[model samples]
Target: MTVEITGIILMFLITVLFAYPLGKYFSKVFKGEKTVTDFMNPVERFFFRVCGIHPDESMNWKQFLKALLTINLLWLVYAFFLLIFQDKLPLNPDGNPGQTPDLAFNTAISFLVNCDLQHYSGESGVTYLTQLFVITFLMFVSAATGITALIAVLNGLREKTTQNLGNFWNIFTKTITRILLPLCIVGAILLVFSGTPSSFDGKDSLTTLQGDNVQVSRGPAAGMIAIKHIGTNGGGWFGANSAHPLENPTYLTNMLEMIMQMIIPLALIFTLGFYLNRRKLARVIFGIMTIGMLCLVIPTIISEIGGNPAIEKMGVSQLTGAMEGKEVRFGPAASGYWSTVTTIISTGSVNSMHDSSMPVSGVMQMLGMMINAFYGGCGVGLLNYLIYIIIAVFISGLMVGRTPEFMGHKVEAREVKIATLVTLLSAFLIKGFTALAAYMVAHHPETGWAVQPANWLNNPSYHGFSEMLYEYTSANANNGSGFEGLGDNNIFWNVTTGFVLLLARFIPIIGPVAIIGLMASKKFIPESPGTLRTDSWTFGVVTLAVIIVINALSFFPALALGPIAEYFSLK
Candidate 1:
């Protein structure tokens, strides 16, 4: 095995160790355990009193679910209205036009739900009010959804111990006030310093790119980009995306952006272990994530190291590595590393164009999207991982000739069914939609929505198929990273992609939240010889097998059609 691949396997083992403590901590916070309370109790009490919240009151799963859905729904409405009313809004630059109805609806749900599916240009059309609304409503809701997921998990933890999770109001207030808002504010400040535009003026700036005095469009870039990452949202303020210097100016800024995108998802795992009082479970999940990351890094390094054939044909000495569509400052190694990591974690921001990558490297990128979109999104990354944990528990139970239990919670038919549903939904949505899109594009050239000819070469190169597979997978998985060669902003793409985003995301979230609620209500079993220690080596192998097999099997046919087909064609 390659070093990167080996690293990935090792990383999984390390992640397993980390996850247990993290999950334990997560459970601890929700249950108001002594360790977490000793530190956060004073803060919680002070804030609850100041904000007039009843910390003692708790809500059931149904109530929690309702509030979570309602908040997101309202935010969606707000995002839609803002997009529709952009021209009339205060933030409009002097000459920009308003959005059409279909476009507005698509964009609203896309942003509010953290879908990142945009059909419109950011620089030319949006006014100040539109940008502000996107920042205020869409970004806020994007971050809010993460908060809601955490609250739901906490509720599950509380139910297991005290029969009451924290109240929705209290949880929401604390999460936003303490965690989301603070991170966003700090992130925004750092982004501004790094040169992401901080202006509301719709006026275009005069800039000489490659020497011509062209007009560079500006908006509330810093404000949006901050929460964009903090919320694990992948939307770019401009078409150039993070590849643009203005959006991602410095090395320091880039690192910060990457770290912030990952922090909450990782932290949530610790929270889970803490609440359950089973550090081992969290470690196993963490191990899986780390292993996934290690897998991501290797192919990326190899691809980058392989360099570009087309570039080589140009008589340029390929000094370092793959150069096409990648930043020289960050280089292929860093770009490849980030690409894999982000896809696995559900943060789809890219520093390089994935479309131009080498075939094998591109395959790994595709794989990450498969893992993320189907698994869970953003803060829900670990939640989806938890589903796999349940599967591991179940399989381990079978091995031991006993019923499987996780953290003393049983893995019954309903729980496994829901978990399975959650895993398969995104795969189905992605592959089915990709096939549909391919057919539509082939049959309807007049739609002007076909894959780019350059991207859809006659050859079956892994790179070519990766670009094709990436489009639907990214949409279906809701990762939002593209090979950058797809025409996804047209009527067909807009509507189809928008539907995939909504259904793929909300439905999967509902599944895990429901499972967590059910598990929380059940009684915890004491550890015994019959109990399968999930943190053990035997369990880890089973966990890895389940995740690897599920993703490989689910995406196999689609992968063959897209990347594999293209690879063979190339040969």
Candidate 2:
């Protein structure tokens, strides 16, 4: 237990160490200041020239969003068709078939939104061409899309008043060329050297030591795995995800993947400080997020390491804790930590099956996604936190006798409305969708879809409710991890969650960026003696309180019916 605890601590600390400097580097790259990867300037220039975009041209918030939506729509159309007809494409060494239309819709939108929720397994869902061209390609671009939006919002905040945030095309291009590509190349090389497959060779059959024959699946997985972790895009190259030996390989790879998933989200927070010259504010935000993270992670580790009490009554030894759905190389403690980290950051990649975890651990995992901003995903983490910050700023002002202001601009009714709507929108999508799924299970079980609603869940009653709730929460949070017990590959789940992915992924983004833009256009009010110090510990406490209160109000009831009730029932 002590050794396992130590490993988790070291993994977290190492991620922090890497994130700080990388964050600084990211700010430099965004600012166009000279850095190690300045050699990519020519390549960026070539792309801008080919696309006929002037890198220096700035855009208003409306123009920025329009371009973002337009390009994304085009990408969606392109990917959907290719996935539908993947069997006709090249790179299918195993001759895998194309995806059904509904599944293709889910898979395409899932990747496009940075959600990466796989209703279909990676090995046989589509061919290698689609995996590389569609899946791997979207992993890079979707992550860059999130980071680019973060930079754009930061631009709105940093200036006292400015109509133009940076150019979307420019920031997006530079993010890929300088940050994501270089890191992925290095990460892919490490994985390839460490025994993960990087070839296009088909499956090879081999007899087990017991003389049982089986065909093993392998592909160009190392590269996809690299982006999957670093980009926080969590669809796996194989069905078992990181739990598969070929995907994770060893304890060292486990540690590496864990660190990669977190570094970008953490680094980007520090980059906010550098970009805005507001290091103090950044520290306060980081402190709050870390505390929130600890609240979720610590309980999870303890619960997982304690094993299942029910199993203990069955007279089975559980000295190593609950090992039911976990890799032995990465025990319960590390698996618990990964579960917390992935859900919190929207990575959704799993080293173990979440369904096999204890009830308390399930609560923590769901809460992490419910709050959705503790550490968040690649670029979306900061964007989501920005929403909470605005709300906190407004509430703090109301408590005192001052007008709500963020940075220099006054936080008006407009900004507050947008923030409140975005917050409530998450609850609505999660609960509304889960309720619909539940109603279908209870009342319309014989509707006879691809998989009947009667067969949607493997576990009966309370545990079954959790599978449905967790799915929508994950969809709403844009976190792609699942309970694995849910029969969710049908048309109903695929189509329903596809639409959820679109709205949940974009509305929060649109809200924050719109707030920043609106505030930037407002009059800048200079700080006075009466002003609230947003960078102070006091404001940080208020911010954390607001987050806690809102999460409780928004999610506690639904949670009570799911994991919380299930915990006591098990007792």
User: How displaced is residue 554 in candidate 2, in Å?
Assistant: 1.2
RMSD of each: 4.6, 0.8
What's each prediction's clash count? 40, 0
Q: What local lDDT score does residue 417 receive in model 2, on the 0 to 100 scale?
A: 99
**TM-scores of the candidates in the order shown:** 0.86, 0.99
Candidate 2 regions off by >4 Å?
none
Clashes of 2: 0
Candidate achieving the largest TM-score: 2
Give the alpha-carbon lDDT of every model: 0.68, 0.92
Query: What is candidate 1's local distance difference test score?
Result: 0.68
Model 1 lDDT tens row, 1-571: 2543444344434544543454454444445555533555577678888977776666776777787788778877777777777777665666677777777777777776665755665665466677666644566666567656766765565444444545776666555555566678888998887778887666565657577676767777887787777777777777766777888886557666766676667767666666555567566666666667677667677767767766767798877677778876666666676677667767677878777666666677778877772223556676666677787787777777898787667779999998888888878887777766565546653544344433343333444445556877777666777776665555666677778778877776777777777877788777787777877767777777888899989987777766556545544
